[model samples]
Target: MVSTNPYNDFLKECQMALQNSIATLHLSIPAISFSLDAPPSPEFGELTSTISFEIGKKIKQQPRSLAKQIVSSIDVKDFPLMSAAKFAGTGYINFYANFAELSKITIDSTLALNDAYGHVQTEKPKNVIVEHTSANPISPINIGKARNPILGDALARILAARGHAVFRHFYIDDVGRQTAVVAYGYKKLGRPSLKEKPDHEIGLIYTLTSCIIEIIRLKLALEKQRNVSTEIKQKLQMQLEDWSSIAAELKGKHPRLFTELLEKISEDKDTENLINKLNQAYEAGEEEAKGLVREVCQLSLDGIKETLTNAEIFFDSWDWESEFTWNSDVTKTLKALKKTGYAFQEGPVLEFDADKVAEDYKLKHMLGIKDDHEIPSLTLTRADGTTLYTTRDIPYSLWKFRKADKVINVVGMEQKLPQQQLKLALWALGYANHAKNLTHFAHNLVTLPGYKMSSRRGRYITFDEVMKEAVKRAREEVEKRSPQLSKEEKERISRIVGIGALKYALIEVDPTKRVVFTWDRVINFERNSAPYIQYSYARSRSILRRVKETPKKFDYSLLTKPLEHDIIWELARYPEVFIISAENFKPNTIADHANLLADKFNSFYTAFPVIKAKPEALSEARLGLVKAVSIVLRNSLSLLGIIAPEKM
Candidate 1:
C-alpha cells in the first residue's frame, strides 16, 4: 500500500526487497501487509511486523531459521529500509523507513494532494444502506439518538465520496408498543403539544403521556401498600383496566404511537381486523384515522427537514410502506407468490414454509425461528379476510427490489430479530425475488452510564438539550479563553465547536459497541477528542494568518525532522483512512486518523517553528507543510460530520 501510495517512492524499493527475499528463498508469499508499528523502545524500528513468523509456520520450519533466510534475501540498493533485519526471539522481522526518504515523500505528497488529498477508488460501489439513528417515536432526538444517525450519515458520506453507492435510511420505528403507550396517555389525560409543530407535537405529547404513566404507576403502588378499603382497591383496579384498554384502542388507532405493538400483534389474529378497520377508514375517507396518519406523516416530514437542514443530513426520498400496497400492486404480488407456492392458503389463513425456505437467506441466523421450528403460522389474512403488516411489508420489500439494485436498512440492533424475520418472510412469500440485495445495517444503542433511555418510561434525554448544553459549555470555554471575542463570534464558534464535539465523540467509536455518554471525554480538549483535532486545525490556520508570503516552491530537501516525517506519513494516508471508514461502515477510522495526525503535527509544531524560523528556505518549507496539514485535517474532520473551525 505504501509503495503504491504516490508520496512514498522508497516504499516500492522496500516492497521489492521483501519480494526478492521471498524469491531467493524459493518461498512464495504472495503479498505482505506493510504497516506502522510501535515497538517497546527506540531500539526497534519505527515500523515492523512478524511476517517472517507467519511464513515460517507455513513452510514448517523453525522461526529463527526462516527469519535468517528472509533477512539474507533482502537487497538494499540505495538507503536501507531498516537499519538491520534482526530475528528477535521467535522469528520477528522488523523494518524501518530511511528518515530522509520518508520525510521527502510525506511532505511532497501532502502538498501535492491539497484538498483532494484523501480520494481513493473503492473495489466496487456495492449498494449499501447503513440504517442508523433509528430512534423510536417517543420524543425528539436525544444525545444518545444522535450517535447512530451521525455515525450512519457520516459513513454514507465517506462511502459515497469514495465512489460507493450508499443509501442512508433513517429508520423510524413508529409502529410498536412504545407508540401504544404514548397513544394511551394521549387518549386518557394528555393533550396534543403543538409547540414542536406537527411531528414535534406528537413527540411532546408522547413525552408528557409517558410522565403521566409514571405518576399513575407510583400512585397505584402507594395505594396497594396502604391499608385502604377493599372497595377502593377494586375501583383503582377498574381504572387501571380502563387505562390499559384505552391504551390498546389508541395503539390500534395509531400504530406509530407504539413501535412494539407491531411486534406483539404482527402474528396475532386481531391484526387482520385492525388492518381492515384501518383500510376501511382509508376507503371511506374516515376523517379521524386519515387525519392522524396525515398528521404523523407531517410530523415525520417536519422532523426530517429540521434535522437535515440544521444538521446537514439529507435524504433523497421518503419511501413509504403504505404506497407499495396499492390495490393492483398488493393483488399482483399475492397472486404471484401463490402461483410460486411460496404462499399457500390453509384453514382460512395464509401460511408460508419459512423454515424450509431459510437456506437461501444469509440473515437466516438472525431470524428467531429455526429450521426445525414450524414455519410460523403467519396470518397473512385475518378471519375477516383483512391484510396485515406482513402483507404490507412483503409488497414493500418487493417494491424496493424493483426500484433499486440493493436496499440498505439503517436500523438499531434491537430490531435485528424482527428485520431478519421480515426478510425471511418476504422471500418465503416470493415478494423479495432479489432478497440477496437486502442489507440490515444494525448498530448498538447509546446508553447513559447508570440508566437506559426508555421512551415508554419517559426516561430519555432530548437532542435539543444535548446541543444546548454543548453550545453553552463551548461558549463558556471560548469566553474563558478569549474574553475579548465578540458575542457574535462566540455564538458562531460555540455552534460549530459544540456540535462538532458531539458528532466527533459519537463517530470516534465502533458502531457495534454501546455508546456511554460521558461529558468528560466528549468535551475534553486533550487526547483523542474533537477539540484536540479542531485545535490542531486552528493552530495550522493561525500559523498561516501571521505569514504574508506564499511560497511558490517548498524545499522538500530541508524537511527532515522526525516529527515532520511522522505527521506527513499520517497526512499521506488520509485517502486510506476514508477508504477504511467507508468500507467498514465505521466513521471512527477518520476520527482516529485525525487524532493521529493532530498528535504528530502538535509534536512538529512545538519542536519546530513554522512562522518564525532562522533559515528562509526551511521556514517556507515548514509553512508549506502546515498548509498541507490544514487541508487534510479539514477534509478528514468534515468526513466525520464535524466542522473544522479556523479559530475555536
Candidate 2:
C-alpha cells in the first residue's frame, strides 16, 4: 500500500530534484525532512535541513566543500520554491519558501477540499468500541470522573467523523465492593426508601460510613497501648456496632466479595475460607447472593443514566457483565484457553502461563513495558465454578474483535495492568485475532482540590453539580452581556456553551496528564480554551451579521491576506490533527489546534476590517474567511462533543 499523501507528494517532488542535484555534483548526501527555518528576522532562508553535516560525514570532506558542490548542481527552474541555498558553518541548508507558490498552494488546497477541507479518508473505516467512564458505584459523578468520558467521547466523535464506525460504551462497576457499602446500608440499616434519589441517598450513607470508619481506625490505634481501659474498650465496641450495622446493610444489598472484609472487621475475627465460601455460594446459584447483586446492579444502572445525562455523555452500548454467564460462547472461550494451556486449572485460580511471555525485549519495550514484566494471573472461573469479571469480558472482547479491525478500551491508568492482563489472557484462550487489535487507552486521574476523587465513599462532585454550576455562571454572564435576549434563548445558549466549555476544558489537556479542575480556567475566554474558540466563532458570526448577506458559496481565491492564509493553513490541517488525535488518544492536540486557528483569525480580524473593506475585493475575501472559520470552528467543537451556538 504505497499511498501518496497529498501534502507530502509536492514535498517529495521538490526533494527529488534536490537529490538529483546532489548526485550530479557528486555530493554524498540525500535530502532530509526539512520544512522551514528562520532567525528572529526574515533575513534567514525560509526552509532548512542539515545536509552539509550528513554529506561531510559520508565523503570525509569538509561540509563547506560539500555545500558548494551541491548548490552548484541546482537548476533554478527545477527548484522554483527555493530562491537560493546557503550553508552556515554548521552544515545547515536553508532555502526560502516561494511566496507566490505558498499563496497558490494554500488557497488551492483550501478551495479544493471546500467544506471537506481538513479531512482525509486515510483507510476504510471500521467499527470501534470505546468503553470509558466506567466509574465505580459512586453517588456523584465528580470532576475527576469527568475526564475519561469527555476524552473518550470526543475521540469517538473524531474517529466517526473520519469515516470510522464508532460505538461508545459506558461501563458501570456495579459489582464492585465500593457500591456494596451503600447497598449493605440499605438492607441492614432499615434505610430510607430514596430510590427516586438513589445517588443522593447512597451519597449520604457513604459519607456517614466513611466518617465512622475513620473514628474506628483512630480508636484501633489507641488500643495499641500497653493497658487499655474497659471504658475505652466498651466505647470502641459501640463504634464497632455502628460500623457493622452500616456494612451489613450495604452488604445485604450488593453481596460484594469485599463485604466479607467488613464482616471480619466487625466480628474481630479473620475468616480464612471467605473466598471459598463465597465462591461456593455463587456456583450453587445462591438466590440471596444473586438477588442482591441484581438489585444493586439495577440501581447502579439507574444512577449511571442520570450521571451521564448530567455530564452530557452518551453511549451506544451499555453491556452487562452478567450477560456472558449465560452466553454459550463464553464456555467455548474457556474451553479453548484450557486446550491451549494459556489457562490451567489450579486448585482455585485460573492462571496465565508464564511460558507465554515474549522473550523479545524489543517488542515488550515497544509496548511500554520493562524487561521480565508479565501480566498478572487471571481468574476466569472460581474454584466453585462461577465466572468472574475477566471471564465475562472475554466474550465481549471476542465480539468486538470480530466486529472491528480495532477495539479501544478508554480506561483509567490504574486499570492499565488489568487491561494488559486481560488482553494476554484472551489471546492465550484462542481469541488471538482480537487480542492483536486491542488497545488500552489509559488516562490519568482527575484530582479535586487537595484530594483525589473516590467514588467508593461518594466523596466527590457530581456531574450534575458541575453542569449546574457552569450553567448558573453562564446564565449570569449572558444576562450581563445580552439582557435584551429572550429568557429561552439565554437558557439554550447557556447550556450549549457552558457544557461545551466544560467538556473542552477537560479535554484540552493530554488525557495521560492529571487534570486539576478549576472554574476560572474552564470558563476563561482566553488562549487554548473552549471559550476562546467559541468566542472566535461568535465573533466571526457577528462580523457576518453586518453584511446582511446570506453566507454565499465559498470562493477561496479572494482569501489573499497573510491572516487569511494563516487561518486557511490551520483549517486545512484539521484532518491531520483529527487522525493524530484519534490514533494517540489525545483530544488536547485537536483543542490546541483549534485554539491556534482562532488566535490567528482574531489577529486577522484586528488588522483587517472585513465588513468595512471594499465590496468586491475585501468583502468577498472577508466573507470567505469568516465562512471558513465558522465551518472549521463548529466542526472542531463538534468533535469534542460540543454544539456551537450561532448566536453565542
Error of 2 at 5 (Å): 8.3
For model 2, the stretches where C-alpha displacement exceeds 4 angstroms are 1-13, 16-20, 23-47, 61-115, 176-182, 188-197, 202-292, 328-332, 342-347, 354-356, 359-363, 379-388, 548-561
Per-model TM values vs. the true structure: 0.79, 0.80
- Using alpha carbons, what is the TM-score of model 2? 0.80
Q: Any idea how many clashes model 2 has?
A: 7
Considering summed lDDT, which 10 consecutive residues are worst modelled in model 2? 1-10
| lDDT (tens digit, per residue) of candidate 1 on 398-447 | 66665566676666777665565567767765545456567676777678
Note the Cα lDDT for every prediction shown: 0.64, 0.65
